[model samples]
Target chain A: MELLSNLALGFGVASSLTNLGFCLIGVLLGTLIGVLPGIGATATIAMLLPITFQLEPVSSLIMLAGIYYGAQYGGSTTAILINMPGESSSAVTAIDGYQMARQGRAGTALATAALGSFFAGSVATFLVALFAPPLTAVALKFGAAEYFSLMVMGLVMSVALAHGSVLKALAMVVLGLLLGMVGTDVYTGAPRFTMGITQFADGLNFVAVAVGVFGIAEILRNLENEHDRQVMTKNISRLFPNRDEFRQMVAPILRGTGIGSVLGILPGGGAILASFASYTVEKKLSKHPEEFGKGALAGVAGPESANNAGAQTSFIPLLTLGIPANPVMALMIGAMIIQGIVPGPNVVSEQPELFWGIIASMWIGNLMLVVLNLPLIGLWVKLLTVPYYVLFPIIMAMCSIGVYSVNSNTYDLFAVAGFGLLGYVLSKLRCEPAPLLLGFVLGPLLEENLRRAMILSRGDPTTFVTRPISATLLVLSLAILVLVFLPQIRKRRDEVFTESDA
Target chain B: MSTKPKDGTDIAAGLLFMAIAGFFAWQGLGLDMGTSTRMGPGYFPMVLSGLLFILGAVILFKAFGRPDDEPMGRIAWRGILFILPAPIFFGLTVRGLGFVPALFVTTLIASQASLRMRPLAALVLSVVVTIMSTLIFSYGLGLPFRRFGPWLPL
Candidate 1:
């Protein structure tokens, strides 16, 4: 009965005119950014972070959630149309979807993508509503030791799953942890790395670091390759899928939704993994594996659905446990902090309306994406040709302004510039920024829990292994670390990454 | 054509990480670094620093084994040149020059990063971006910032 009431309340809040309008706006902006190469959902969210400050917390969250999932749907459009993915999750779609487009079946591929995403999104949203409360109930029992161990597991898994060398990822995570400790020490009340600067007392601004790394660094990276992408928008025949195509898509879509929903719950496994896993599974299951890269409708359907579903369900970890599974969720944590809401297990019991409202809005956002994107494909395709030269300047200006607005100070602008350069240099060195951000977000929490657990156990480090839940989590982290380092698994991970590029 | 060094990126990355760890460790040494029962601000940092340094060393050694990593591939020095300065210039000028003027200058500077963009087109793009940003961010969104600097007429 309580669950029913919660769902009813969520629906009521989400149906409000203001929330609905923001949802529409979020998806529209998400799709526009998602249609463009080199500007992804992570960077887009970081740039638009300032706008969330002006709106109500609930509405802002609804809008942000809308942007996150909406990007997944939009990413496939660019992948299918141009053979260039706007986001990593949609990279697989380009393999088959672009070939479909070249054969003058662009409309059919687009339709299949949209319909498959909608179906998966709907099921995943329902799964979220059903599963989130129970997950929160379990997380509520977690103590300091368990929390610390859980954070370790999350960080380790992020290292294990991140692109490039595992050693490099570990270094980035450690670097992030160090960067996070730049502010005043929580226990000692002494400024650790502030160097007597007033702004350093509060810490390096989250908005600054995120925008600099994701937004500015991305702009820098995109501009490095000034060559224009050739977008194929015309020569579309038959928008709707034929009877045979529809029948072929049904099984892949269902299987993808299941895989995505499950994978979305795992630490460091999200939309990208869900899409890649589903595509591989579908390829293996198909009668004609040869058709995979040659305009297979099932290829387009499965991964598209999986990614959308995974994007929706990825919110579960953030909402229920107050932990971010990736960089996008890390930015969400910053947004939540700004809204004066601590992202953790108690959030559901404390603010049921905000939680449920966001959940309900996701379903609505998916519906809006299908309706909005399907007809406006031509418009999105046009936006892609705006030229990066004209676009980068506006983005740069907005990024500085967005960072400045966070504290109404110029110092953070300098911080943004510094981090932008750092991001660029490190990325060039083949280190991914996601794990760093994840580690940065969790750094303070990890330290706090470690400190508290130590105090409780009188400095017995073995307490982490003695406690049941904590021990299991620590073991899982160790196991995953070991597995990632194993030659066979590492080879498979590289193949998975390469296949996405293919 | 010059031959690029193999695993050059990994070697550089490892060294940089180690340098950062050295700084953290040095700073940690300056702090109290209390016992496990009562950790000072520097205790956890020192431990973390040591671990990071060891990890960096491992990464460096590994690069020796995989020295045949895909060559560094085309460096975007043009982007590096224009993109970095654009924000620094804005930060320096925004307070004195106001949002629109600062933004205009920044846009012009950054526009040069793209080889394909002509001057007239860049100018046109700047005007449009300045006006739209002023309207949307300042007026429409009610972001509390001066539209123009004190030197400019209101």
Candidate 2:
């Protein structure tokens, strides 16, 4: 009864003319960026963050959330149309999606991806509505120690999930943690890495790092293969899936939802991991796993569903606990902060309308994406023909303008360029930037919590181990770390990592 | 011995990272990190430097152990030139040229990195982009765009 009433209030807020318009704009831009190879939702959102400063809080969040999930939809389009994936989450979809495109079944493949994403999004939104209040109540019990442990677990899992060598990933994670220490120390009002520079006082901006690593590095990568034009021609077949195709996909969709829902609860286990795990599970379950690379509809359906589901559910941690699971969620947290809304347990009770409205808007946004994308596929395909030479310069200019508008700081422009070079080098070295981002966001939070926990317990180290929740999380993280390093797991790790190539 | 690209790249990256870590650690040593009671200023950075040094050492060790497997191609100087010179250009033009001209020129140079674009097409596209961006950012959004000098026409 309470959930229903809250949802009603949410719909009332979400259906406002202004909010709806922003949501539409967000999904539209999200899909466009998603369709463009080498750009991810994080980069797109970061680049657009400055534009949102003037928007109403609800409108900004709604739009930002729309971009996050809409990219899931748009990302699948590129994966299906071109062999390239705009985001890591869509890599699994590219396996069978590109193959289906080759086989002239691109229409059906796209339809399944769209429908599956919509269904998964609806289900996840329903789960959020049903569980958010209770979850927030539970989250309220978390102390500083518990949060530290939880962040530690998240960091470990991120390292484990990274595709390359664990050592390299760990190094990157530590590097990220170090980079995160650049700003002022929050607990003590002392500057740590500022080097007497005023700009460093605020620390490295997540938006700058995100844009540099994902957006600029991606442009560099695109430039490398500028001569190789992607072939986007595909014969449009049946838009809707046939009964046979439906039968094959239903089980995978269910499995994907299950995987995605669970993974989404874990910090750092958003769309990327959900899609990757879903694809792996589907392939492992298939009798003819070889067909996975040859355009299995299940390959497209499962991962696409999981990706959308994960994208939606990742909001749970952000709204309920005030901890962002990924960079996109971090930006959302930044938005909420800008609005002067303290996220966490109080959000649900104090701002039920904002919480539920955002949830409801997600469903509306998903429906909008499906309707908008189906007919617009033809137009999006036309976008691919836009020469990279023309497109990239525009993107770079937008990035510059956006960064400048944020604080009117020319220093940040140089920062972006510096980070761009760093990002390119990191990419060349096969180091994943996402972990670094996760570390950067979580680092301050973790340090703050660590100090708080220590102060609360009078510098007692037992605080972490004595807290049941924290202990459990620490144990779980340690177990995962151990498992990842196991000889057997190491051998199979390559298989799981290289599955992205499919 | 066949030189593997991965091995060589890893070693180079490891060395570079190690050097960076070393420099940071050295810099950190100059800071007065407060104690736990005083809440020293250098506490966080010093800890970070230590961790970075350890990680750098691990990377260096890993690089040394790996054998080069393939030959690496020559560095793409064109791509480097296109991207590497951007910061210098931005720094020079940002204040005097203002945001619009600075952004336009920087983007134009960056676009030249794309091997696919013919010089003529790149130039035309750069102009179009500059105009569109100018209109959208400067005029539509009301972001402050600098006008020309006192003697210059609008």
Candidate 3:
């Protein structure tokens, strides 16, 4: 009954005209970015975050969440219609989904993906509601030491999940933390790394860094080869799947949702991992394993379901602990801070409407994607034909406006250019940017917690190990680091990533 | 073999990391680093810088004798030249030329990053993008931005 009443309250808030409208806009815009290649949800969310500053906290967050899911749905559509997946999470979907399109079953593949995502999203939303409160209770009991160790674990997890060399990723994280340390120190008003620039005393703008690293850097990467994309616009027949196809997808969708719900709660890019994991699971379990990568319906169904579930449930960490599970969640934390709500376990008690509204909006947003995207698949296919050259200019202009509008500081725009160059160089060296971005977001918080804990314990270094929760988290981080370094696991990790890349 | 082949990309990356770490460490020395119980502003950064330096050194050391070595692909020189400067141009001129003109020029500069974009197409794209952004961000969204600045004499 308590859960039911809470659900009713959430629906009551989310179903309001203004909130619903924002949700629609968010998902639509999210899908637009998702359908397009080269631009990612992280970059689009970063560029558009400033615009949301004008709305109510709940409305803005609702819209942003919608964008996240809509982008996921849109990514799958592109994967099925064209071999190019608009997002990395949908890369596995492209394997069999594109094959289906070649066989004139693009409609079936798209429908399967949409249905699977919708089902998984619904289940994940319930799971978030059922589990978030309890998790928040645990998080609320955490002391400064526990928080510090937890963040250390999160950073370690991010480094572990990052692509390519672990050493390079660790360096990126440290570099990000150093970048975060640039502004004035909180404990003492002494300036740290501002380099005598007064404008940077408040720290480098988060928006500028995000846009530069993800958006502008992406444009540069895309420009390395200006090749034409092959769009499968024809033979998209039968919007609804047949009975046999529906039956085939049901099991994979269920298994995927289960796998995704669990993994999505983990830190560091769980949605991408969830989808890949689902594909491997489905392939192993399938009787016709040979059909995989050759238009198996489960390939389209399972990963799509797993990814959507993972994407929805990834919010658990953000909502419960105020820690970002991934980069997009980091931006969400930024949005919350800008809205003047200090993100933590207290948000559940202090801002129930904001908490529940977002949970409810996920279901609503998924429903809209299923209803609106199917009929509008033709339009999205058409968008795929737009030249990449035309798109980058528009993106650049938007990035300028978006970053400038954040603080109305021209220095932020200049920072965007600087970070963009830095991001491009890092990528050229084959370094992943995700860990760096995560480190940047968590940097100040991590330092604050470490300092607070140190002061609380009278500068005793053993406090981290003395506390049970903190000790456990540190052990976990150590275990993860060891696992990643082990020659066998390292080889397997590389194989997994390389498989997804192909 | 007299000498082991090295991964050029990893070598460059390692050196870059080391240089960055050294810079931060050198700068950190200027700030006050307090004792264990009462840490200074520079303490955490100094520790991080040291960690980074070690990581860089390890990466550099491991780069040699590795079998895998893929050539670094063609660099985006054109994109770097045009795309990187677009935001800088907008930042320098947005207050002077105002939102409309600044955004217009930014788009124009950015479009040139692609060899596929013709001059006329770029011009038309810039014009349309500027107008749409002006309408949406300036008027529709009601962001307080001057359409034209005093520099334009309009």
Q: Which candidate is the best by DockQ?
A: 3
What DockQ do you compute for every candidate structure?
0.68, 0.46, 0.89
Residue-wise C-alpha lDDT for candidate 3, range A404-455, written one tens digit per residue:
9998899999999999999999999999999999999999999999999999
Q: Write the per-residue lDDT of candidate 1 for residues A1-502, one digit (tens) a residue.
A: 8778888999899999999999999999888778877777887787788878999999998888888877877888899988989888899999999999999999999999999999999999998899999999999999999999989988997898788799999999999998888888899887777767887788888888888788778887787667777777775657889999899999999999998888887767488888889999999999999998999998999999998888888889899999887788888888899999999998899999999999999999999998888789888878877777778777777776677777777778888888988998888888988888888888889998999999999999999999999999999999999999999999999998887777
lDDT score of model 3?
A: 0.93
Please give me the DockQ of candidate 3 compared with the native complex.
0.89
Model 3 chain A: worst 10 consecutive residues (lDDT sum): A493-502
Q: Candidate 2, clashing residue pairs?
A: B3-B70, B4-B68, B4-B69, B4-B70, B34-B40
Residues A245-343, candidate 2, lDDT per residue (tens digit)? 888889888888878877887787567889988988998999889998899988988988898888888888888888877778877876687678987
Docking class of 3: high
Give chain A TM for each model in order.
Answer: 0.98, 0.96, 0.99
- What is the TM-score (0 to 1) of candidate 3? 0.99
Checking candidate 1 for backbone clashes, the offending pairs are: none
TM-score of each: 0.97, 0.94, 0.99
Among all candidates shown, the one with the greatest lDDT: 3
Q: How far is candidate 1 from the true structure (C-alpha RMSD, Å)?
A: 1.9
